[model samples]
Target: MKDLFHKSLSRRSFLRYIAATMATTAVDWFKIEAMASTVEPKSDYPVVVIGAGIGGLVAATYLAKNGFPVTVIEQHDVPGGYVTSFERGEFKFDVAPHYTLGLSPFLEYLGIQEKVELVKPPEFFRVITPEHDLILPQEDPRGIIRVLSEKFPHEEQGIKSFMSLLNGLLQEWVKPFDMKTISSTHPIMWNLSKLNTAQVFDQHFKDPRLKAVLCIFGSGFGLPPSRLPALVFSPGTAASIYVGREYVKPCGQGFSNALMQAIENNRGRVILKTEVESILAKDGTVTGVRTTNGKTYTAKAVISNASAPATFEKMLSPGHVPDSYMAKLRTYRPSHSYFLVWLGLNKELRGKFKGFQNVVIPEHYDPEDDDKATSACNASKTRFQVYIYDALYSGYSKPGKSTVKILMQCGYRPWKHFEADYFAGKKEAYRKEKDRIAQILIERAESKVIPGLKSMIEVMDAATPLTHRRYTKNPEGAVLGYEHSMDNYWIYRNKNRTPIKGLYLASAWGSPGGGVNPVVRGGQSAFTDLMLDWAKIK
Candidate 1:
């Protein structure tokens, strides 16, 4: 089943979108207190974690398993942040696509790997455009590169150089992925940083079209290649070159389940539906947190998997925080959010499409076009990047049913497009937009594949920026942390350590930015910070 995710990653294959399909049973993480043993451990334990999302959970698991008791608190009924799923009658929607999944060394360091379910997809990304398309097999990125070179023969040189660079960066390293640690110790990274992603592309990629294709990898961070540091792309591309740069995990059953299991298996405590509204801070050091409900739990150290802005803005007293840190949070740009079309269909799409992922780039579309599109959406009119999930995930496909999910990437800015008069709540607005955009998207995709998919309506649903905000607590509904702007990406990418003493930031909001793989890597880095040096008292 996991191999399906790897295989579907090849952009040229239509078989990736095939899915087995679902229903409306709500998973209550709270009631499953059985998962939480009768023994309430971690009393007076060293660390207290805020938000049981991926980063927080990983950090908690590592700390607890290493003999330090840890407590993980969450605002939601369930954990996993965006990496969770919900069922509506026969349809199940994975709110976000998480691919290239990996559990960092931190998992092994804590020795809880067996408690979690982890699998590497056979391959990760499948690239598609009207002009050229391909099925990039895992460990065979050259196949996709050939397709790109074949598409634009005049740009073969640029294409080859681009793929080579990306492949080298994403390769699995014997060393853990860490932006801060590696920059100081790894000479390879030091040399790579000489040229930022933009400078590298300008220096080698003469073909603008090829540049657009190669740089799309930057999308892993909600960034464009031109703006990213070459160092960021280096490690990022290494993984993509091997498996097409995308991987998928079940947010509901797979990801969240693994997180909770790991936490409990390590003797840690997880409490959900409890939002930590304010941190109980003293002078300049640490303490515990007070949930909005007024319950307070004390601990020696606090780690946050919440977004950098939320932790600083809402949790800690603004006065205790550094002015510099506050300014960084206040001004930090959140990532571009998304709009989704989730569908439950009655037919098998395996034969209809060869790839699990299909990407459509309009003729001569400029990579910068993404910037303009997101900006326009910030104001009113917004364009979209179409993601068709029809071929690879058989898990979503029931015995006789299939699922079709499409993604329309829009900026969080345009969420205000709904007039204040018609601002209807999240659920209401989502229902209205589902019909309107679903029709348009059906027309667009049907013309490309299903011939008449516009009529194949069994079930349909939509999610707007507001939905992302409500579910993920992403401010302004930004899907992937802060938006990646040229001026801010390098500096704005937060560090794992925060100014508030005894606290650290994990997850995509910090270094390594967003995407499941990098965040996993970020978890490993965060653990090293806690155990290796930071805690080794002289």
Candidate 2:
């Protein structure tokens, strides 16, 4: 009966049609308010954007500035994906540490730098272990080198050479997809150092302690250096010292404020709390999106920042997607998700170690051996990238207080250890698990840094994979989108626009490969395609 109704009206029935057995009115209204359209007339935006993430918002803002009408749809109640913050009795905590590294260049390009304030935190990242407690100072390469030299006096050359090569690599490594040349000789430096993270640390350094420290660095992305593509090692590591020792939004620049204000400024409409059940397609082409609340959004093109797998696997008709596209999609692995621990302290964690981040590496960590263990879930030891980011905004927390967010990556099997009933219910079930994990993080934090951290916490919270998917719409709640190695980084990255016509992809999985810079870079690639359509009318 439902199929008959769907096929009978075809185009006219598109505005509203559904299964009577399902509760259409019970759809998530918060989602609709975030992504739905409010304009009464069937107005068409030159570019229709889906998922108002960092990439989508940056693209939408630019297109609108050029006098193009735009509409952005998101599945969450808020616009910013990982670039967000929440409040608890005058205390606010960030879900993701999105400040510092990529914010300046990316935001400045959009001319919206003034829109969000970026402040430089005292330290970037700290490393604490039984052997060494390293403080990564701001841009003091000699100081850094001296510190490492003392740790591994015999392996000083290895440390110095590694940093030199990594620096040279980062400066020459930024080859966006748009760059036509990718030859080994492109950087054309008087001195060239080509050592993938694994090669440099493993081949040259023999000390287990030194190898553990360097290899453990890859744990920043929840993967070992051996698993990370060699090319990214340069920019990836150098970014921390060279680019990372910089600035970030205080309470986190509120990526939504940046995008929403741009929408209002450009006169673009943003709707929220609505759900898009499916993309109506005809003869392998996108016709429009059918909101669960009976609203439809249509245009010449649709840009989906939602997870590619979710869209093709669940949202679109299987008949419409070609077999080859389906095959390639299957080959692409969804990256691992995170088990995050969010915290709000009664008073600011002050003193020397305060306002610092710690990437705690477990004792006896090895590079070559760690990746395999982590992948197989045989990791007896682990590491964490800690961000001691307190209130960036003036009022997010009362004066003299701060908040810290700690992120660690793990397999879904941990939380999914039991039946669905274990965590199957409203958002509250997830919240309870959050409390469970929050204790672990705080306990671990106290052991690493403070003697009594549990007492320091006035407020505590946690977010699970379910929470990640609920907000980001990421498949399986993957954080860095797709996990890649040297073998997968190149061809594995899909083109900005897929074979799906009038539908473009602009998310972490799309291009540039996750993080703030890559998301916007991927968005620009899709926008280039959008400009071609705009040129037609001009």
Candidate 3:
């Protein structure tokens, strides 16, 4: 039924249809008008969101739905920030990981799940090492245990204990906390916040291979076990992968487009290619923003979806932010970025690969060593994960073709010089370095796991840290925002509220860390803060 309806109408059209339908039927116009009359002032703009990333878009949509006049300013020509897609000939590939978990609640909160389609991949992922190849199942701890036990019969009890911990931690995180009483000494999350990922794993499992498998979970968040906070990494990542039905769209474009449509349907404005030069404020209260295009927009409040450093250091004057806050932002450690290689194949490779996500892990995989090694670009030292969209959803590629993405761990410092060199008449060297790295990665994949992968590639493009920085404007190309370490969890994480009144942050830099779903939730949290302020207004 959904396929037929979607076939007849586009996602944007369907969103608009629902918006019109709700306006006429579902919503009580009288109550809305009464609320507006009682609370809303005669202001041209009440909220201005900077950066049209998922977080900013979600916030804008929610505020606009509640009758607040909102405008979103994005420097990119498109929305979604890192959660976006691109097309090359017959292929479409997602820049970020294609699979996402914990969507139902978020979609339900937005009341748009019915308007969007999500494709669930068959399993979690396939982990390939030199000695073992294991296919991990999703949402089934027992199944995972059974499979791992078959590989190492003696460690069955260890596997069971680890699985129990994963599930237990997940439950602990989902428990609601009382905001009024929540503090550093809060019983609910204090111990978890103090624990690191490696410490918990070492205490539970003795098998090195088992520990390696678990460490990969932290890699997904761009952290190593030693540095990753147990509370944030264990429960958050487990909830995402093992506690729910996992799903992904054909690509991220539809999801991004749908959010944009939802915002417009709610009467919010999204201005693309307009860079916000500085956040306007007076007496420590947000007034509006000035854009690079020489236009000033006024609003009662502001939400920043850009990185914390970008928001505080670059977008505002030094006087507007406190020295303590500036020092904190400077000292806060950012997470590792990624190097991606996108491929368009002639035909579906799933018959041989047989998995949606295939990871090529080194036999001597050490999370701490790999995490340190990513500080520089080296193809041989890097681990790679390959995503075959055609394995589950064929729409990402043409009729018989497939779309594959290879993501490698990388740091921003190695490619930092490329940008400077480009302007200094050394464009050839920059291009050559990127091409050389791409070729090396391709060869490495072909030799290690997927043979004939080079011949299958019809279109290819590579993105370094510099490429990500160029497009997303993330300082230092830090894709996952602040590092999810012991020091940056719960009370230590950046809060939505700033010292400046009417200013808030809704990005990966804030609490709960990065990823499409978490950032979307971050946006929702920011919206709640905005609503509280609105409730207190005259």
What tens digits encode model 3's per-residue C-alpha lDDT throughout 1-538? 0111123333344334333322222234354344445555635448999999988998888777777788999999889898788778867778888455646555665677766678777777688877788888875556777788888787777766666666554434433455565443344355556678888887777777777776766676777777777777765555545533354565676777778888888888999999999998888988999998789999888999988888888888879999988888787777778888998988667676767777877756776667766677777776778777777765656777878778887988888777787647677888898888888888877776678999888999988887787888887778888876667765577777788889999898986568776677677767766655555674
- Local distance difference test, candidate 3: 0.74
Per-residue CA lDDT of model 2 for 1-538, tens digit only, reads 0121123333222212111101112233233222223322224545677777777786677666655678887777777788777777767777776644545544555566787676655654467867888876654556677787888899887777777665555434432222244454445221222334566566568787877776544554555665566555555556555544443555544656776788768877666676677877787678778777778877667777778887788778778888898887788777777777766676665553543567777765665454444443332355655666642334445666667777766665555543255346544555566676666666777788656667777776777766677677686677777765453454446766677777777777776567765676666666665554444433
List the candidate 1 regions with Cα displacement exceeding 4 Å: 1-44, 101-124, 167-196, 243-252, 378-390, 393-395, 417-434, 484-492, 532-538
What TM-score, computed on C-alpha atoms, does each candidate reach?
A: 0.81, 0.82, 0.89
Q: Which candidate is the best by lDDT?
A: 3
**Deviating ranges (above 4 Å) for candidate 3:** 1-38, 42-45, 178-190, 423-426
lDDT of 3 at 414: 82
Per-residue lDDT value at 494 in model 1: 70
lDDT of each: 0.61, 0.62, 0.74
